[model samples]
Target: MSHLLNRLTPRRGLLLIGLVSALALGGALVAQHFFGLRPCTLCHYQRIPHATLVVLGGLGGLLPLGLSTRRWLLAVGCLVALVGLGLAGWHVGVEQHWWAGTASCQAGGAQATSLADLRAQLAAGPAQPACDEITWSLFGLTMAGYNVLVFSALALLAGALAGGAPRPK
Candidate 1:
């Protein structure tokens, strides 16, 4: 473990982080397409951070950047990971009914102002899946819960890597 950490340069670490995020995103997509686990609004929202991290990681790894710039990129990645952690935690709470989801997820949107509006809304196709519903789980942990764990670890790793990297002279 120490040998691995010692060899984890910023560029390599960022690339690894990016690869992990991409894998997670791919898994989510596979779950959606192959297994027919439709994502709710919150689930879609949860994907943004991973997408951002993928871009950040790729750029940080590929670019010929100075130590300070590399550290800055990693810092940004850490922040993004924290944001993902928050989103996933919130999603888990919603799924567990600890708090209400958005209006769209509860009671199926704003009460139609009139019959015509109701019909029009109904014609717009099915309402998006409720955020509070757990569409998938493993070992009693929903995907969002697993996301919380993953993002938290990512954030800590990125932060530590960024902070520990030697400063440019």
Candidate 2:
């Protein structure tokens, strides 16, 4: 495993990170569209960092960027991953009822003063899932829990790779 990790150049590492982000987004889409799992507002918030990382990693890996630029991108990716980790951890806490969720998580009441307002609210679409609800879990861990783990690993990998000293030519 160490040998494999050693072989991953900065370019390759960035590409790998982009690919992983893409895969994670794809999986979430599959779960939402095919499996019929609705995402809450917090879940939507958690995806933002992954989307940013996808662009950062892709640009750093695919473009003719300088070494310093690549390292900078990786450092940004690390920060994004840490932000994602925080979001996911917050979501897990919401799921476990350890704390209250955001206002958007409560979709129970949509007050409408008039018929037009009621129609507009109804036409807007179905209410999103509550953040506190655990839609799926494995080994007593929800998707947010898994996200915490994934983002933690990504943060560590990106930070380490970004800070690595360049080899003497």
Candidate 3:
């Protein structure tokens, strides 16, 4: 694995990571805008790590950073990917009805206990789509399920990049 990492320079690896993150975010936007699929709370939450990776990868890949610095950035990216994985997994559980979703996941003020609370919720803008609702799916996997797979791969890739970054002479 280190041998393979040796061939791919840290700069190139970081750039690839950044590009992948950008594509993932862009795809989500396209789905929302072009397809009219409203995003739920968890869907929005899953994008945070990708956004961070875009910045980290851009800085590590494009800047005149030392090899050690690039490796550190890759390590951070690994952690961020792991965080994303957990969030996506949780979302999958919600979609599967394995567990209850967060309060904000209720799309119809289902969490309101009092008439006043319901009134306040109504006064707010339209409720977000329910996190548990599978708005889109492919092969029995929702977007969150696909995100789980992506994040897992990203975590592995970032870890490999960090470990494979050549040691400073």
Candidate 4:
């Protein structure tokens, strides 16, 4: 374990982080498409940070950027990861009914004050899944909960990497 940790320089760590982000995104997509798990508005929002991390980490790893530039990228990645953590935390709150989700998760159709309005609302499709509802869980932890853990660790790692660490060979 010590030998493996010693071998993980900043650049290499960034590459690994990027790969993890990509895998997480891929898994989310698979859960949505293959497993038929519909994502709520917040669920969709949670994917943005991972996507950003994928781009940042990939570029930082592949491009011949200077140390300062790489550090900047890692800093940006840290910020993105923090944002993801916040979103995931909020999602967990929503799932636990500690707070309400965005209006998109609620009934979509506008309130009908008249017959025409009612008809218009009826024409619209069914309401999307509420963000407060947990579609899946493992050991009482929702995907959002897992995201909180993952992004928290990622943010810390990115922050450390951004602190002028030596680049990997």
Candidate 3 contains a number of clashing pairs equal to 0
Off by over 4 Å in 3: 1-4, 110-125, 165-169
- In terms of lDDT, which candidate is strongest? 3
Candidate 4 per-residue lDDT, tens place, 101-136, comes to: 787877453578999988876777455577887889
Each model's TM-score? 0.87, 0.92, 0.86, 0.85
Preferred candidate (TM-score higher): 1 or 4? 1
Minimal lDDT window, size 10, model 4: 1-10
Candidate 1, residues 65-111, lDDT tens digits: the string is 87778788889999999999999998999999899877666635666
Report how far residue 92 has shifted in candidate 1, in Å: 0.6
Cα lDDT of candidate 3 equals 0.86
lDDT of 2 by residue, 29-140 (tens): 8999999998899999989988988898899889988888888888999999999999999999999899999888886546789999889889887778889989898899
Misplaced by over 4 Å in model 4 are 1-5, 107-127, 164-169
lDDT of each: 0.85, 0.86, 0.86, 0.85
User: Which residue pairs in candidate 2 have backbone atoms (N, alpha carbon, C) closer than 3 angstroms, thus clashing?
Assistant: none
**Model 1 poorest 10 in a row by lDDT:** 102-111
TM-score of the candidate numbered 2? 0.92
